[model samples]
Target: MKILNKTMISVLCSSLLAAGPVRFINPTNSYAAESDVENNTGFNVENSTSTANTHNFSLVNPDTNIDVDIKYTDNTVTVTTITNGAEEHTFTYNQSNGFALLDGKIMNLEINEPDFVIDSEETLSPQISLFATPSDKPVFVSPGNISFSESVDSVGKVVAVITGAVVLAKMIGVTLPKKLIETKVQDALTLIGLGSAIALNTMSGSFTYGLYRTKDKFYTGYPGSVNSYQYKFRYQDMAVNASLLGKTMNINFSEVGSWWFQSKPM
Candidate 1:
C-alpha cells in the first residue's frame, strides 16, 4: 500500500512538469525584446554645428521604424509617422510645446541675460526682466545683473569720446570754433553740448531703450550624445485680389491657395 501511494505521487508530479510548470516556468523569456530608445520630437538646436552642440541640434529619430510627417502651427509642432508598410500605414497625431529632458551638459551651456524693458514708470528701480523666445515665457537662463542697470560708464565713455573728438578737432582745425563765426563749428558745438547733457542724464538709456530684436539661437552638449535641431516655417499669400479691414487681416484667394513645402538643405 505504501509503495503504491509513493508511485501515485511521483506520477502526478511528472504530469505537472510535462504540462508546463505554473510556478517555475519563466514568462519573462518570451517578453524580452530590444530596448527601443529614440526620441519622437526633434530638438531645434540653433547653429549647433555638431551633435553635442545643445542649442544647435538635429531631429532625433522616432522609436520603431516608420515614415513620418511633421507639422507645426503657432509655437506647436506635430509629427505623424506610418507605423506599418501596409495596413499600409495610416496614423494621425497632434502635439504642442513638446520638449525632451536633455542630458546635463545641455543645461550647463552658457546663456546670457535676455533683453528686457525697464519699467521706470511703475517702480523706483524696476529691474530688468528676461523674456521668452518666439514666445514670452520667462527666460530659461539669465544673468543675475543686466547690462542695463549701470550704463553710466557706457554713457560716459561715449560722451568722453565725443568730447575728445571735438576738442581734438578744435585743436586740429577740423572743427569750427565760436571764434570762427557763422561757421558750422558754432552750430555743431551747440548741438553737441545739448546732446551730451541729455545723454549724460540718460546714461542708462530711456525707458523705451533696447535692441529691437532678440538673439534666438543658442548651443549645448558634447559630441555624440545630443543632437542639434533647427526649424523654420513660412507662408506667402498668392492672390489676385485682397482687402484689409481695420484690426483685421484677411486673405482672399483668386483661384487657388498658396503652396507650402518643408525641408532643410543638405
Candidate 2:
C-alpha cells in the first residue's frame, strides 16, 4: 500500500513538471504570484488582500501546491508554485506484455517521536537512521535541502559569551592586575569560555527535503493510464545531542507536498 502511494505520487509530480507551471488562488485575494525559483523549495507569498491571514503555501514534486490555513476564520490562502520535474520513467518490458497498475494512494507523511534535536546553544543535528519504515522503499536517491536545519553564529556567540563572562568574573573578584594578565591567560580564557561554541563547531547534523518528481511507466496499465505518475514528499530525520550535553533544545518539522497527475495524450 505504501509502495503504491509513493509510486503514484511520483507519477503525478512528474506530470506537473513535464507539462508547464500550475497556479493556486484563494479567489478572495487577487495577489501576484511567485516566479519559478530555480530548484528551490518552500514559498513566500505576495498577498494583495488587506484581510489575508497567515498560512503556508507549498509545492512538491512533479508540481503541486497546497494552501494550509493557519486559522479557520482566515479565508485568504491561495497562489501556486511553478514546477518543472521529470515527465518520464523507464520500465522493463518482458513476457508480461500487459500489466495493469492497480489504483492506490500516492503520498505519505509521518513525524513520529523525533528524528531531530537542537541543543541549548542552538546547534541542530538530524538522525538519519529514523527515516521511513520501508513499506515500499521508493529508491530514495537524495532529495534536496530541507530547512529543518542547524546553523550557528560562532563569532557572534563567542563575543557575547566572552563579554558576559568578563562581567561575571569582575563581579566575583577574579580580576588579576593588568600587568600580570599574561597572553597565556587570555588564550586559556578564550578556550574555556568557548566550551559551548566548541561543541557547536564540532557538532554535525544532516537533513534532506524538496521537490522530487519521477514517473513510473507500467507496461500493464490501461492505454491512457500510462500517463499517470505520483508526486512524492519525502523526509528522514533522527538527531541526537552531543554526548557532553543531553538534548536540551530542538526544532521539529513535519512536511507535506501535493500530488496531482496531468497528461495531454490523445
Candidate 3:
C-alpha cells in the first residue's frame, strides 16, 4: 500500500495546531449536546423538534462561524451551509438514487452502498482497512492491518485507543511535542502489527475509519495479477481521523467537500 511521506504528515500537524478546536453547539440550547439521537456517529445535534418522519439539526462550528443545517426525512438528507448568516451552498442526498445533488444539480459523485460481512473470521480477528476514491478510481487504499487487537471487536478498541490518546494529550499541556504525537500514533499502529514509522507515514492524508474487516487476511489474490484483491466497501457516514500535534482530529465524512473536523486544546 502507498504511504504518506513524513513531510506531508508534518505539514498537516502544523496546520491543525494553528487552527485550534472547532466547537459544535446547538443554537437552540444554551449548552452543548453530548449525544446523538439517531446514530452513535459522534455528531452533535442542535434542534430535535420535528415531525416523526423528519429530523432537523444544525452543526455550528463557532471557530469558523459556519452553520450547517441538516434535515433528514425518510431516506433523503439535505444539507445546507450558511456562512455569516447567509446561505452559501446546499446539497441533497437520496438513499434511492445514491447520488448527491448540489444546489439542485446532480454532481458526478456516487455513494456506494455499504457491504458489511459478519462471519467466523471477524470473530477471530478484527481490523480496519480504508479505501477511498475521488472518482471511479481509488486514490487511497490502506492495508487491512491498520488497527488490530486480540479482542473480538478490534474496530471499537482501536477507536477507543485513539480517543483516549487525544484526551491524554490534552491533559499533558497546551503545546504538545512532536515526539508525543508520534508515540501515540505508534502505539495504535503497533496494536495492528505495523512499525511506528510506517504507521505515521501511512495515515498522513484523508483517511476514513469505517472500512474494516474482521478477518486477519490482508489480501486474497496475487499482488500483481489482474484478478488481484480489491476493496468494495463503502458507507454513507465515515469516521475520518488525523493525528496531529499529539491530538487526533475526528471528522465525519459525508461528501467530498462537505466534511468538518474538530480540534481540542493540547
Candidate 4:
C-alpha cells in the first residue's frame, strides 16, 4: 500500500508539472446566469425574462474576463466563450450528455439534478450550479477526516492481550478461577465488535474535496466542467487539523495567487 501510494502521488505530481506553468486569475463578483449553466445539464428551466433564447454573461478574475454566450434550440444547447476577449471556443450537447462548459478557465456549468427536483426552486442563480475559478494549476486537495488505521492497530493490540490472558488461564486453570477467564474473554470479544463498527462508520462518510487552481482563482465544484481532467491521490498522509476545518488552505501557491476559496464553505 505504501509503495502504491507513493507511485500514485509521483504520477499526479508529474502530470501537474508537465501540464504547464500553474496560474490563477483574480476572482470577481461578476456572475454568470444560472439558466446558461443549467441548460447544459439537462434540466428544463423557464427562460429568464432577461433573455429569450440567448444568455450572455461574463465571469471575471480580478484581471481577466471570461465572456460566456449560450444558445438554446429545440433539441440541443450550444455554449460559447471568449476568454479575456481572446479566441472563441464552443461546446454543444444534448440530454444524453450530462454537462456543458463555457470555457476551461471559467465556470463549468452543471445542475444539481437530484437536489434541484427536491428543492423545487429554479430561479436563475448560482445556488444550484457549480462555479469555476480561472487557472491552469492542475489540482488542489483538501484534507479529509482522520484515517482509521490507528484504530485498527489498537484493536489488534487488545486482541493480542486477550489471547495471552486466555492462554495463561488455560495453563493455570488448576489454581485460577474459571468464571473470571470466561468473563474476560467475553468482554474482549464485545470490545472488538464495537471498535470495528465505530471504525467503519467513521470512514463511511469521509471524502476529500479537491479543486484545480489557476494563478488568480481556485476552481472548485466544477466536477466535469470543460478542461477539467480526472486526477487521483491518496489521503493517508494528508491531514487537516480539527482546528482548520472549514478554512481556506493557506499553503504554498502564494506567489501571484491567493487561496481565498476555502475547502469548507464552498
Top TM-score prediction, candidate number: 3
RMSD of 4: 30.3
Candidate 4 lowest-lDDT run of ten = 111-120
Cα lDDT tens digits, model 3, 129-185, are 446222232222222111111111222223223432222222111212222322333
lDDT per model, in order?
Answer: 0.20, 0.22, 0.31, 0.27
- Model 4 TM-score relative to the real fold: 0.21
The global Cα lDDT (0 to 1) of model 1 is 0.20
lDDT per residue for candidate 4 within 80-192, as digits (tens), equals 54545664655443332322222232222211100001111231111232355434443333321211111112222222223222221111011112222223323333323
In order of appearance, the predictions have TM-scores of 0.14, 0.20, 0.29, 0.21
Candidate 3 backbone overlaps, count:
1
How does model 4 fare in lDDT?
0.27
Over 4 Å off in model 2, which ranges? Answer: 1-200, 209-226, 229-251, 260-266
- Point to the candidate with the largest lDDT: 3
Worst 10 residues of 3 by lDDT: 143-152
How does candidate 2 score on lDDT? 0.22
Misplaced by over 4 Å in model 3 are 1-65, 108-238, 241-266
RMSD per prediction, one decimal? 35.2, 25.3, 20.7, 30.3
Ranking by lDDT: 3, 4, 2, 1
